[model samples]
Target chain A: MAPVSLVSLGKAFGSIEAVRDIDLEIADNEFVVLVGPSGCGKSTTLRMIAGLETISRGELRIGETVVNHLSPGERDIAMVFQNYALYPHMNVAQNIAFGLRHRNLSRAEIKAAVLDAARLLDIEALLDRRPKALSGGQRQRVAMGRAIVRRPKVFLFDEPLSNLDAKLRAQMRIEIKRLHQRVPTTTIFVTHDQVEAMTMADRVVVMNNGVIEQVGTPLDVYNKPATRFVAEFIGSPSMNFFDGTLEAQGEDLVFRIGNGRALPVPRARGSAYSKHFGKRLTLGLRPEALSVSDASDFTIEVETKVVEPLGVETIVYFDLAGHPASVRAAPNRAPRAGETVPLSFDMTFMHLIDPEDGSVIPY
Target chain B: MVSRGGILANVATYAAAVLIAAFFLVPLTWLVSLALRTPQEIFFGASRFIPENPTLDNFGQVLRDRGFLNYLWNALKLSGLGALGSVIVAAPAAYAFSRFDFRGRGVMMMAILAVQMVSGLVILIPLYRYMGWLGLLETHVGVIAIYIAIGLPITVWLLKTAFDGVPIVLEEAAAIDGYGHFETFLRITLPLASPGMASALILNMILNWSQFLVPFIMLSRDAQWPISVAIYNYAGSTTASTTHLLAAACLITILPAILAFLLLQRAIVSALTAGAIKG
Candidate 1:
């Protein structure tokens, strides 16, 4: 078990840069998930850490060794690729024991290690089958078994569950978390799915456009995002942004919108936006924060455009003076599509984004 | 489930196929008929298409007096070693061509193609001079060398296509599993490309066995002649007719080709998709 550190990492393919200036420290026995959309350089960063890709200009240290010049075998990292690149000619036992073939171990030791991995992954019955004969989920388990038998210093997974169906993906996500708990190896998993990051990561690193937007626990990133990109990207039915200008009237700050509505800013962090009075900024509000409150400081009247009743909560989508917005309300109190109702924001949980640069003006 | 039009079309297809099969089968039947008859029957047309008397005496004359056994051994050694040596030498070069990234890769492949595209007769005089300087004019090794050179370009291209079809991830997985590049290639990629390797070996053997020009240009000794050249010796003489010995030797030569086709036709079919459709 050892920590890995990457400092000022950058990668380029000729003139086009893929990843730029990334620095991250993964502690020993910690599970970190890199979450982003496609082309965000998340997989490239994981490959660089796994020693599969050459480091363009950076220093990468694993445990105590600077591993920029090391091969993947020298780095002691096991990677489970997205497609499960199993040797088609080898059976399950051979696939699991392949990593130990060159190890200075006896036959009995290799057999025992393979048996242990099969037991842990519950693939004992499948030890003799080929990959093409196994189901998708079984193949994934075999892939994990191959990685875990080696018990490398670091485990890297590149979207291992993306090939599974929905129910199986959820089940394997929990199994992967349990495996991490049991083995406690420093693991780095990369995926474009945010739900997997939220459910499985000890810490989540959100990336966009080849840059790290924020790195924190799932709840912290969901609650207090540090940028407009993070604020919009971290939630399902993403946050709504409305163009508004700030006005400091008397001793309070208010947001003036085009629909002749002025919202009172929460006074708990009014000083952060005090200097930006009369300046154009963007106001962000999550759908869950907007409930059906009759009397609230932040209120807007909207005619419902679409009502989605998902049993636990009903989401109502409507246009806010030509900008699309949504509200989460009790399912029993869900209004019809043609009805008009007033939605309220709790005001303290509102996100303020600077329009000049796509960063949040932290309160 | 059969429609009227579909049945008619299938009947037509079967008719066309049977006609094509008969077109190829007639010459074989005639050859067998020719080998079973005596030279007197062949010249006078006294025997029918079915011989009145079939005899092993023609095979005996071919084996005992016509040097059939020596020619068969010489041809087998030449063709077998030529094909085997070509595959062994071309595999690593093809692997390097497919997997590495360096300057002039495209140019090197194109250069190979250019050399293969050139007329073999254009280089004949120079090749003869080169062989003479090496004192390799009349040996089996010299003929084998020429056959391997003729087989190299096509064999390398075939094996390169197979190597390219294998995913690099398997090799990377092997590397992470503690095997080096040499071991990974031997244990992983080579086994996956077995069908292609088998196909290339068979194709090279066929190519080497059928070649006549290089043997004519290289070997001047009658004792070192391959079966193809020996067959010409019996048939191309001015005093000879289409003797029973030539027909017996020709029939004997077809056995090896038939055996090879029976054994390797599946390997060739599987080679078209090996390492390509699997993980």
Candidate 2:
């Protein structure tokens, strides 16, 4: 497999830019995921790589050659669509062997290749059944088999697991990741699901409004998300943000929310916030980053709203200085709704974002 | 919890449905009774729904006549060939209409609808003159060509609609699998839209099989006359004034059309328009 690279690739439908001039280079055998909200151009970029949609501007290179002018057939890439796109009229075996038929492969060669794929995908017994007869997961495997039989230079997946139910989605997600590990083709997978991105990708490319927000490893982006968009978008039960101002209270760097409630920006991150003394900023804290604290160590007092008991750990929802926020706590320690509680940030996990631009405040 | 009003509404609905069925079925039952009767019974004796001595003699006579057989063959050839030719021409054309965004796609679609929009009678004389200029009159080929022209617009429109319903993603999938647009169309789009194509073919056959005007205008020569034209001429023939013989020939001509309707009536109706509207 060869590397796929995009240099300032941009696509526009008339005046509306679907994808802005974006740059990315996917290394050979890497599983890179483009994760974003819908209409953020992740699918558009994957389609551009597959030669399904035209690259309106900038360069697209699959392997060593520029493929902007190439047709999908000439580009030598296989795509797994969200709906699985198995030809309804063909049986499973024919569907898997479809791509190879166009090549100069012999009959025996095609059969062997198809059987190999069917076996690899655990669909050997289903080769005779038409797509309508198979379950959704089976059809998806057939789709993957179709792609794998081609053994193309690049593999593009556009929300491939979106159609399956939650349990099946989780199962197929592992199967896809496992398939990638075995095959290791230069793969560009696009999905709006951040969990899929975090679980499967070697690198996650976060995007919003047709522009790339950040590109890094899943943990790198998760731990130090470069923008507010990426920071909140990457985690479940999304990170909470409080609109506030940063001011120096002598030795303490205090964040003052409305109603004169001030939370100290832990002394460890003092060097980072020392430069933004009186500037307006947004403080972000995940549910896990906040812990039930005593009044002496408390950042602020919050009135509890709803307590969700999740067996292992209960999630306490409360209004933190008029903004909705949650705190991770033990089930026994979780406070009841309408009761006020003291909470403090884990400090090392806090995300301070610039409201003027949405970029994360650098430490 | 049976409401009096609800029971009355159900009874009224069923009674209306039966009335409508009888309204259509009465003529068909009358036709069968007429075809079974002897010439004496039809022309002079009491006109009854059931004959005193019901006979298949009229059917035997109609089937035995060489002219009648020739007419039947010509009609079958014209309609069958016309339907096949129309589908063959329309499949790719419809696929193009469905998938491609050419410079004149909207204009072309408008033109297809325009063909159906304009009354055939309005263009009949011109079509006749055009066919005459080509010396295409008085032949089965000429009549079939006319049938194709009449069927082409709707066939293309309906098939295009069906092709539209087959997701373009399948074609894209085929392309990624190393097939060209043509192969994708043939193996993917065409097979997926088979129901629509079959509907178009059956509808075209039914249309051409029963067409009285186009065939009547084109195939004036006795050797090339389809059963529809022959039946039309039979109404004017002095030798076939006997009601039983006339009814028998009429039954023969309409039999294929009735059977076509019975077999693919839903197919024809469901594929009337393109995509979401399904007109």
Candidate 3:
């Protein structure tokens, strides 16, 4: 395994820039996931690293060798495509052994390697079956086996689990993590699904448009999203935003919303916004941070528009001034629609964003 | 659970199909009957649909003819080589058309397709002159070259569509598997496209087998004549006694093409319609 570094890497198709200049260093044996919405250049970045796509400008190095000018075969990388591009004509064993053809391995060595990979993937019984005969999950396993059998310097996955059902995707996610733990190859996985990125990556690189928004451990990105895009994109049900101006009330700061209701910011966190008092800001709140309990620092009464009770927890969606917001509550305590429920805000978990540029305040 | 209306529609469809089949099959049946007849029956009972007494003597006599065997060999050689050569020459161009987005690709494809619209007879004289200047006249190579040229446009189109049906991602997967561009095409794309190549081969074989004018003009010696032209020659010199022999020769010439179609019918149809619906 070897580290990969992309120094000011970019990709352009004619005049349209698909991936802007982005720098990243991926350590050897590290599992890095590039997560973003569709067309966010995550896949483009992965493809560039795999040498499937050419770099428009800047350098890409795998270990110490620059691979910007190399073809995919010359780059010593294996990619598992979204569709699990197994050769339909070849059975599983042949498909898995396909890469070894250029490795100068003897027939016995290749056979043994194929068997070992099949056993590792728990696909020994499927060795003689063609890809068409395999189920979705089995096909995905074979795709992984094809990549892992080569023991290439890096493994590239382009939304490989996107083709599977939800349960299968979850199972494969863990299987991939376990596989990486066992082999510890440097891997770059790209996905539009944030949950996959959060659960799988050693470090999550959240991208937007064509640039990196944040690159950190999943908790770092989730707990302290660096930008408004990261705060919204990384969470299910999304974070809510309210346009407001910060006002000083004694020593504590208060966030005054459009409707003129004020949420008193906790005094311990007030110093971070004291300098920005009277400036327009957007307050970001995670759904889980709002509850019916009075344990929070600030509280507001909202007329619930929808309540979704998902057994474990309930999500109460409401309009905060003019913006949509939701609060997660205990399933037994969810307020019904149209009810004026007291929603408490956990100010310690809140983010104050710069409304002009969508950047979160350092605090 | 077919409804009454559906049953009626099915009956009507079958009736129309049978009528169309009869439109083409009656002459073929008559030819078979003529081929089975004795010389006496062929001479006196030509109007009858069924022979008074059928005999295998005509088939036996035609099969024994050295000239007929030579014509059969010539036809097989020319058609086989033409089909194989056409696919070999067309496959790379087809792959380019299928996979690459070079400038003017669509326009070039249209230009290649336009070649098929022109009748072979329109170009046969010029082709014959060109072959003569190249010292290829009256040779198997001359006739086969014309066949390959005439067959190329459709072969290229058939193979292009076949190549298209083989997913692009498979090639990418092969590339990541350490296979170069040519190796990927050979090992991944070509195998996936075998049905199309098979279809193209059979199609060109059928087209070149029945070819008359090109070989009829390019080949001067009767010894070098393919079955189609040889059969035509035989029909021109037919006497009353040899009419049954001529019918047997016609059946011999037509059987190979029909058998080839019957054998590879599924491959041909699948190649034609494979990519109509994609996942």
Candidate 4:
């Protein structure tokens, strides 16, 4: 296993830059996930690391050696594609043993490796089946077996779990994590699913428009998103934003919404936001941070627009001073559509963002 | 609950299918009947669909002709070698067209397809002069070379479509698996595209087997004449007197092609439909 380093790595297709010069250093045995929406360049960065795409600028190092000019095989990287990409003509044993063809190994060694991979993937019984005969999950496991059988320097995954159903995706997610724990291979997984990123990655690198927005541990990025995009993207149901200005009302400060509703800034946060008084800003609040039972400094009555009861918790979409907002409340406490309900914004977890640049205002 | 309109549509579809089938089948049936009939029945008897006095005498006569055996060997050698050579030459070129995203790829593919539109008849005299200048006239090598050129464009196009059905990700996976370009092609891409290659080989073989103008113009020696040229010569030399033998010879010339199609129809159909069904 090797630590992968992308030093100002960039990729350009004619005039369009698919991946901007982005620098990242992944520790050996770290499971770093590059997560974003489609066209965010997550896959491009992963492919560049895998040597599938040429890096137009900067250097890439794997295990302290510059690998920018090396081929994928020479760099010793194994990748699992979004579609699994198993050879349709080969059975499971052959598929897993295919990578070993170029190596100087005896037939018994190849057979043992294949059997070991099959055992690790719990696919021992499927060693004789062709890919067409396998289920989606089985195919995914076979793809995994093909990669891990080689024991390459770095494992690259390009949205490997995207093709499975939700239930299977979750199961495979745990299996991948468990496999990593067992082998501790340095892996770079590219996916657009934030949940997968949060659950599986040691660190999540959030990207947007070919640029990395944030790179931190899952909890770090979730609890303290570096930018407004991360604040919305990392959380479920997304964080709601209010467009208004921070107004100083005599002795205290209050955030004035578009419809003239003033949410009082807590005394503890008065000094932190006092400098931005009378300037237009955006307030970011996650769905889970707004509650129906708790009372806080920014409590307001809203007209509920829609209520989605998700078994454990209910998400209520409402209008907060002319801006759309959502809050997570207990299933029994959720109000019906068109009903007026009081939601207390937990300012402790509130994020004050600068409206001009979509960056969170440092407090 | 089928509707009345649906029933009418089904009837119309069946009628159209039957008409198309008859259009092709009637000639084959007539050829077979003539081949089985006596010379008198063909020349003097009433025009009937079925032969009253059927016999294998014509087939026996055609097979007994010493020249026919030489013609059959020449035809098999040319067709088999031409088909095999065309597939071997076209595979790598088709793989490049299918997999690589180089400049002028679209233009090159269009150019190859454009070659298909020009028939051998259009350049028959020029081809003869060129073959003579190369001192390859009246030779089997010259004729097979021309057959390969004639088969290249369609063979490349068909094989390219087949190669397109293979996912590029498989190649990338192979690349990561430590296989080089030639090895990856031989082990992964080639095996996956075998159905398309099979169809291309069979199609080229059939086309070369029925090739008439090329060998007819290039070769004057009866020993080197393929089945098509020999049949044409036979028909010309004994137009009325040996009509039954001529028909029997024509049927023999086409039997291999018909048998090949019957044996490998699934491969041809699957190769053609693979790209259509693939998402």
Question: Which residue runs does candidate 2 get wrong by more than 4 Å?
Answer: B1-23, B44-46, B102-111, B238-241, B273-279
| lDDT at B120, model 4 | 87
- Cα lDDT, all candidates: 0.87, 0.87, 0.91, 0.90
Per-residue lDDT of A272-299 in model 4, one digit per residue for the tens? 8878888999988788878875465456
Q: Best to worst by DockQ, what's the order? A: 2, 4, 3, 1
Q: Candidate 4 at A96: error in angstroms? A: 0.5
Q: Which tens-of-lDDT digit does each residue in A40-105 have in candidate 1?
A: 999999988877788898899999999999988999889999989899999999999999887899
Give the range where candidate 2 chain A is weakest over 10 consecutive residues by summed lDDT: A293-302
Interface RMSD of 1: 0.9
CA shift at B220, candidate 2, in angstroms? 2.0
Candidate 1 chain B, poorest ten consecutive residues by summed lDDT = B237-246
Across residues A1-363, which tens digit of lDDT does each residue of candidate 2 receive?
999889999999889999997999889999999999999999998888888899899999988999999999999899999999999999999998889987999999999999998888999999999999999999999999999998989999999999999999999999999999888898889999999999999999998999999999999998899999998899877888988898888888888886677877788888877888888889888888887777446566678889888889988888766788888889888888788887877666777899889999988
Please give, as one word, the docking class of candidate 1.
Answer: medium
Root mean square deviation (Cα) for candidate 4? 2.2
Going through the candidates in order, their DockQ values are 0.73, 0.88, 0.83, 0.86
The TM-scores, one per candidate, come to 0.91, 0.95, 0.96, 0.95
Model 2: per-residue Cα lDDT over B10-87, one tens digit each: 999999999999998887777778788877677643456688899999889988999999999988999999999898
Over 4 Å off, model 1: A292-299, A306-311, A329-341, B1-26, B38-40, B44-66, B237-242, B269-279
Worst 10 residues of 3 chain A by lDDT: A292-301
